[model samples]
Every structure is written in C-alpha cells, then in structure tokens.
Target: MIEVYTDAASKGNPGKSGIGIVIKAGKADVEYSFPIGTYSNHEAEFHAVIKALELCKVQYPKEILSFRTDSKIVVDTVEKNYTKNNNFLPLLERIQELSGHFPLFFIKWIPEKQNQRADRLAKEGIHK
Candidate 1:
C-alpha cells in the first residue's frame, strides 16, 4: 500500500496557486511542489491529486492508492458525498475521469495540521 498526502493553496480565491504532494512507500518519502499558476484553490487541489496519480503510475503502478487531503472541496467531490459549486465542475469531472485509471483508490480528508508536509510543499510551490 502506498500513501500519498496532498494539499494546495491560492493567494486569493482566484489567484496564484500551487499543488503539493508527499508520497510514502515503506521507508521512502518523496515530496513534490508544483506552481499551478492562477487558479482557485479548489482547482489547485485537483491538480495536486492528478499530479500525485501521475507520479504513482511511475513509482507504484500496481499498488493500491490511499490518499489524504485536507481540502473539503476535493475530498467531498471525489467521494461523491457533496454537491460542488459550478466553478468547480470542470476540475471535478477531470478528477472523476482520472480515478478510472486506478485499480484501487481511496481519498480521505484529514485535519490541516496532520497534513503538514504537503502543506509546506504547497506554500513553497506558491513562491516558486
């Protein structure tokens, strides 16, 4: 099993943004921070998940994916447990489509403090 922790942020609702991801496989931990340009935080969150999935394809193609994120918009939308506002529909659809590629997937919402590493990456992404 592989655990990927992800997070994203925007300076404003529709402003500079970034996506961050931390992948853990046994004793190895890898971190990624990507500048996603001007977008809403929700969009950045989706980007983070997409980026994480892409990385997983290279590093753990056959492993079950368990992802943790603190973004309510992302977690709720992916779980199909909540309705998304119109602004997020496109990204939501993309995420739904991406999930089809995985053999097994799980995404859960965790407390922001518990998702520190990814959070740090996201903040770093903002500046880079």
Candidate 2:
C-alpha cells in the first residue's frame, strides 16, 4: 500500500493558503508543496487531501492507499462518508470520487507532532 501524509495551512482564516503532501511507496518517497490561493484553514486541509489523492491516482493507480492527516474534521468527514456542512459538500464529494478509483483506501488522523514534515512543507508553501 502507498502511504501518504498531507497537511495545509492558511496565513489567516481566509487568507493565503498552501498544501503539502508526502507519498511513500516501498523504498521510494516524494514530497510536494504548492500554493492553493486564499482559503480557510479547513478548506485548505480538504484541498490538500484532494491534491494528494489526485497525485496518487496518477502515480499509483489500482494500488491500495493509506492516508494520514492532522485534521480530525477531515478524517471524520471522510470516515462517515457524509458531512452536514453545506460548504464542505463539494469538497467531500470530490474526495469520495477520487477514493473510488483506488481498490482500497483508508484515512487516519494523527496528532500534529506526528505530522510535522507535511506541516512544515505546508508552512513553506504559504509564502510561495
């Protein structure tokens, strides 16, 4: 299974934002960081997952995927397969659609300390 760690950050609640992702498959690993324009922190978090999944679909098609994130809200939203918040409906739908391409997909929530690498990359992206 391919393992992926992702994170996102916004300079302000709805200010400059960025996304970071780290993908590990066997002995190989890759990292990505990019600016995501202005969005809320939560929105950025969702986008990070979307970006990571998009990359995975292209690079590791038909493979099982295990994704880790620091955002509990994202994890819960994905796990439950539903979200009551209307603003997140589209984002959640996109995630669900991306996940369907993989034979198996799992999303886990880790503490902030455990997700430092992706967090740092996300912070760096904010200035780009």
Candidate 3:
C-alpha cells in the first residue's frame, strides 16, 4: 500500500492558499507543494487530497492508497463519501472520480504534530 500525507495552509480565510503532500511507496518517497491560487483553509485541505490522488493515479496506478491528513473535514467527507457544503461538492466530486482509478483508497485523520512535514511544506507553498 502506498502511504500519502497531505496538508494545506491559507494566509487567511479565502486567502492565498496552498497544498503539501508526501507520498511513500516502498523505497520511493516524494514531497510536493503547490500554490493553489486562493481558497479557504477547508477548501485547501480538500484540494490537497485531490492533488495527491491525481499524482498517485499517474504514478502508482492500481496500487492501494492510504491517505493521511490533518483536516478532519476532509477525512469525514471522504469516509462518508458526502458533503453538504456547496463549495466542497465539486471538489469532492473530483476526488471521488480520481480515487476510483486505484484498486483501493482510504483516508485517515492525523494530529498536527504527526503531520509536521506536510504542514511545513504547505506553509511554504503559500508564498510560492
């Protein structure tokens, strides 16, 4: 199974935002950061997962995917496969579509400290 850690940071609510992701698959480990224009922190979190899944789709293909994020909203929304928030609906749809490319996909919520690397990358991304 491939392990993925994702995080997002925003300078302010609906402000400049970015996403960070770390992927671990056997001996290959990679880190990624992206300045994703502007969005609220919650939206950024959702985008981080979407980005990670997209990356995995091209690189890992039929691999099993396990994702970790510091955002409970992302974890809950993905586990339940639903979100009532309108802003997240489209992003959620994209995530759902991308995840289906893998043999299996799952996400878990991690504490901030446990997600420090991705957190740092996300903070750095805001300025990029």
Candidate 4:
C-alpha cells in the first residue's frame, strides 16, 4: 500500500492556490508542491488528492492507495463519492476516475496539526 498525505492553501477564495503531496511507497518517500493556478481552498485540496493519484498511476499502479488530508470536504466527498457543490463536482469525478486505476483506494481526515509537512509545502507553493 502507498501512503499519501496531501494539503492545499489558497491566498484567497478563488485566488492563487497550490497543492502539496507526500507519498510513501514502501521504502521510497516522495514529496511534491506545485502551483495549481487560481482556485478556492476547497478546490485546491481536492486537486492535491487528484495530483497524488495521477502520480501514483504511473509510479505505483498496482499498489493500494491510502490518503490522509486535513480537508474534511475532500475526505467526506471522497468517502461518499458525492458532493452537492457544483465547483467540486468535477474535482470529485476526477478523483473517482483516477482511483479506478488502483486496486483499492482510501482517504482519511486528520487534524491540521497532523498534516503539518504537507501544510508547509502547500504554503510554500502559494509563494512560488
């Protein structure tokens, strides 16, 4: 199983945003922080998961995915596989599609302090 921790930070609502991801695949641990243009904080959180899945699709295709995030919106929406927010629909669908490539996928919600590494990386992205 691959363990992934992800986070996002936006300067403002629908403003400059980015995503941070930390993936642990066996002995190899990787981290990523990338700008995602302008999006709401919720949208950026969803994108972090999306980008992590996309990366795993190529790097760890057969591995099960276990993701951790501080964003309840991302965790709840992914767990239920549904969201009423229109802006989130596409992001949710993209996650579902990406998740299909793995044998199994799971996401858990954690407190913000528990996600500090990813949080710092996300903030780093915002300034870049």
Candidate 5:
C-alpha cells in the first residue's frame, strides 16, 4: 500500500499558494513541494491531492493508495463523491478520473498536528 500525506498553504485567502506531498511505500518515502502561483486555500488543497495522485499513478500505478489530508472539505467532498460548489466541480471530476487508475483509493481527514511534515513543506513551497 502507498500512503500519501498532502497539504496546501496560501499566503492569503486567494493569494500565493503551494502544495506539498509525501509518499510512503514500505520503507521508501519521498517528499515533493511546488509553488502553485495563486489560488484559494480550498483550491490549493484540491490541487495538492491531484498532484499527489498524479505522482502515484506514475510511480505506483497498480498499488492501492491511502491519502491523508488536513482539509475536512477535501476529505468530505471526495468521500461523498459530490460537492455543491460549482467552482470545484472540475477539480472533483479530475480527482475521480485519477482515482479510477488505482486498485483502491482512500482518503482520510487528519488533524493538523498529524500532518506537520506536509504542512512544513507546503509553507516552504509558498516562499519559493
């Protein structure tokens, strides 16, 4: 199983943002951080999940993925397979499309403290 921890940070509500993803597969682990220019916090969160899944599809295509995020909105939205916000529909669709590639895909909401690593990386991304 591949365990992925993801987070996103924005300097402002709809300002500069970045994404952080940490992937752990058995004894191996990898970290990625990238600046996403400008986006809202929710948008950044969705983007982070998308980026993590995209990386997994390339590196661990056939493996099951267990994704963890600190954003309740993201976890709940994905779990329900639906969202009321039209602005996020495209992002949700992309996530659903990406999830289809995995044998199993699961996302859980974690506390901010539990997602510290990803949080730090995301902050780093904001400055970059």
Candidate 6:
C-alpha cells in the first residue's frame, strides 16, 4: 500500500495557486510541486487531489492507494459525508471517476501541521 499526502495554497482567495504532494512507500519518499495558476483555494484543493491521483497512476499503478489531505471540503466530498455544491459537481464527478480506476482507494483528512511537507510545496509552487 502507498500513502500520499497532499495540499494546495493560494496567494489570495482566488489568486495564484499551487499544489504540493508527497508520496511515501515504505522507506522511500517522493515529493512534487506545481504551479496551478489563478483559482480559488477550493479549486486548488481539487487540483491537488487530481494531480496526486495522476502521480499515483504513474508511480504505483495497479496498487491500493491511501491519500491524505488537510482540506476538509475535499476529504468530506470524496468520502460522501457532505454534498458538493453546484460549482463543484464537475470536480467531484471527476474525482469519483478517477477513484474507480484504482483497485482500492481512501481519502482521509488530517491536521494542517501534520501535512507540512505538502503544505510547504504548495506554498513554494505559488512563488515559482
């Protein structure tokens, strides 16, 4: 099994954004950061999840994956504990579709401090 940590950040509420991700398998660790351009924090969060899934597809294809994020909205929506708004329906659909591609998947919400690696990458992405 693989454990993935992810986070996203924005300069403003709907300003320049970035995504950060950390993938861990046993003792090995991988990190990625990308500038996602102007978007709301919520959108950036969704983008981070999408990017994480894409990375997982390439790095750990055909394996069970467990993902962690600090975004309650994203974690709740994907976990089906909360309903997504009309504006986010499309993104939710895409996430759902992406989840189906994996043999096993899990999305869990953790404290922001616990996701510092990804959080730092996301902030770095915003500057780069």
Top candidate by lDDT? 5
State the displacement of the C-alpha of residue 64, model 5, in Å, after optimal TM-score superposition: 0.3
How far residue 75's Cα lies from its native spot in candidate 3, in Å, is 0.6
Clashing pairs in 3: none
TM-scores of the candidates are 0.91, 0.98, 0.98, 0.97, 0.98, 0.94
Per-candidate clashes come to 0, 0, 0, 0, 0, 0
Instruction: Give lDDT tens digits, candidate 2, residues 37-104.
Output: 99999989999999999999999998999999999999999999999988788999999999999999
Residue range 11-112, candidate 3, lDDT tens digits = 999999989999999998899999999999999999999999999999999999999998999999988989999999999999999999988999999999
Q: Which stretches of candidate 2 lie over 4 Å from their true place?
A: none
Question: TM-score for model 4?
Answer: 0.97
- Whole-model lDDT, model 4: 0.93
- Location of the lowest summed lDDT over 10 successive residues in candidate 6: 81-90
* Weakest lDDT window of 10 consecutive positions for candidate 3: 74-83
lDDT of 3 at 62: 90
Better of 1 and 5 by lDDT: 5
Q: Candidate 2's error at 94, in angstroms? A: 0.2
Tell me the lDDT of model 2 at 69. Answer: 99
Give the alpha carbon lDDT tens digit for every residue of 1-128 in model 1.
89999999899988899888999999999999999899888888888998898888878888889999999778888888345487677667776666667788999999999999999999899999
Overall lDDT per candidate, in order of appearance: 0.88, 0.95, 0.95, 0.93, 0.96, 0.91
Q: Which tens-of-lDDT digit does each residue in 1-128 have in candidate 4?
A: 89999999999998999889999888988989999999999999999999999999999999999999999989999999899999999999999999999999999999999898899889888988
- lDDT for position 111 in model 3: 97
